[model samples]
Target: MEDRNNNNNEIYALIIGAGISGIVLARLLAEKNQKVLIIEKRNNIGGNCYDYIDKNGINIHKYGPHIFRTDNGKIWQFLSRFTAWHEYKHKVRAIIEGKEIPIPVNFTSIDTLFDTTKAKVFKEKLISKYGKNEKVPILELKKTDDKDLRELAAFIYEKVFYHYTLKQWDLKPEELAGDALARVPVYTSYYDGYFTEKYQAIPQNGYTKMFENILNHPNIKVQLNTDFKDLKNTKYKYLFYSGPIDEYFNYRLGALPYRSLNFEFKTLPQKQFQSVAVVNYTSKEPFTRITEFKHFFNQKIGQTTVAYEYPAAFELNKNERYYPIPKQENEQLYKKYLQLAEKEKNIYFIGRLGEYKYYSMQSAIAAIFELVKKIAT
Candidate 1:
């Protein structure tokens, strides 16, 4: 990695990791006439959100399927400036008892899983207790006094939540944070959409292209395949790190727990493999979900690509950190790291691994916007 000449051009901000948070922050600061230098350990710029057109002309998400959905108009508008959207609302299904059912346990799912009379009674009871179109967590629903509703919750827990949670997080639903478990709620209505956000979309070109456009600024300089540790004695006014906060401190304060994923990609000589973009394996399959790439933008190619996601333990220097394990003890450890971080000057920890939080695409961008606001103030 070639070092930048600080005499000719002084870097106003040095950003680690060219992921969504780092790229967005670089763009925001560059717009403010700040000279930004972004270094990424990976050769790619978009990090885990990177996508490319394969031999079949299908846009494949390298890591996994990421459906951009958020209620914030500001985040939507901000991303819209870079690329047009596909206007996609993601849908998911899970195989239960040799049948494909919509996830989040909707009315259709209930109708498919149970007998006609029982399904009708369950739906009516759900609407009466939780109101129509409302989402109820399986854990919360298990506490209901209604025997039928409790039965329904138990069925969902055993068939949908239990085995899948065990495979995804290596823990039960009750072990995770409340908000984490509530992510897949049972809708009271017939809505089968996976996400309920107002705005859900994917970039028209690709996420990599959108990121390329984001970093296409005069004041922003990007260096790929360059590790932060290799850049010794680099000078900058401010440092914005989007990598793991624990790794930055050399693991003196203990390592935070995270869940990693291994993807097995296959190019089948067929038009389509699945009905939807993603399908969860809630039963005996060791892998949690499979994603068909061609379904995302409706690519009209003869061949299709799919990825089977296998969740694994996040071993240091072995695999990529995908999810921060949400536990009370993990949060306490992160707070200790936060205390040490707060003592530093002009250095900010951002993004999922950096802050040790589970953040969606929009949430990550919103966080960068807030960080920009703080810097401006």
Candidate 2:
């Protein structure tokens, strides 16, 4: 990799924000023998997926918990070259009515929340209508004709999703886009796992180290503590931006709304803090969830680190943008910026912030795969 300098005459691509999208694209372009320069406002790469081993020998996710799960074999294989897998399946629990139950309102969750007979009836009704192992969206479940099923839906919606959505996005479930609310579905079976992807695991070492391997190429250069606006005169064949599209245009139209997060990390002396890796505080808690980092890879350590995630409004120059608010007006405003982006040549807006869409880690990489295929061809 080249050293940090203002020289850009030999650069073929300039990627802003050294997140997963930027680093992956840089690696891909470098493989094609194209000179790529990545500028990041932060000193580190991996963005929200960044993780590091602390003194207690626990791999702590700096932002929050990131579990890599993908159905796409090609995308998984692409990342497999960088690091070995830990082979982990994440399980999450949410506190509802002072009892810990599996999220997505699974069969076990139903049993824990409801009486034996009622839980049996609810499960039977759900299976009769949607079939076993089918994941039903909370909203779609509410549309059922059966009164008992509708009652169960109401119970799950109120206990599991309603307050959680409000705390996470500062908006009610109905206010946000349908896709956002559908992410956490009602599982019809006894599956207690958080995700149902074919491949679910974490990097054996860490995300940062894997990213280091990805960026360890001769043609790729990384410049830390550098913003794209500072490189006004640098010349590049193409520009791939992963930062907020509104900020790229200096918010000339208007600042796009986003949700930010603040984490209170604590290293507990005990062997375990929670039974599961993550526990959502669904009711009456200011913070959304508490993540136990040691469970990601089951690292055998005496000390465990947990992060208390508190959602907040995205303030300029205050905190990092985590989630883009998925309201209709926000999408319409994003389109305005998209129009301006289309007019620019050799420039592509990729990833969550750039596209103004909520993307899982796999989805982000999948989007980049398509972008690289189009550009490389």
Candidate 2 wrongly placed segments (more than 4 Å) = 1-9
Candidate 2 accuracy as lDDT: 0.90
Summarize candidate 1's per-residue lDDT along 1-377 as a digit string, tens digits. 02233345778899999999999999998888778999999989998899998887889999899889999999989999999999898899999999999988899999999999999999999999999999998889999999999999999999999999999999888899749988889999889999999999999999999999999999899999999989988888888999999999998799999999999999999998999999999987989999998888988878989999999999998998999998899999999999999999888999987899988899999999998887786
lDDT of 2 by residue, 42-109 (tens): 88888889988888888989989999999999989999999999999999999888889998779999
lDDT of 2 at 24: 91
* Best candidate according to TM-score: 1
Q: What local lDDT score does residue 243 receive in model 2, on the 0 to 100 scale?
A: 92
Q: What are the models' TM-scores?
A: 0.97, 0.96
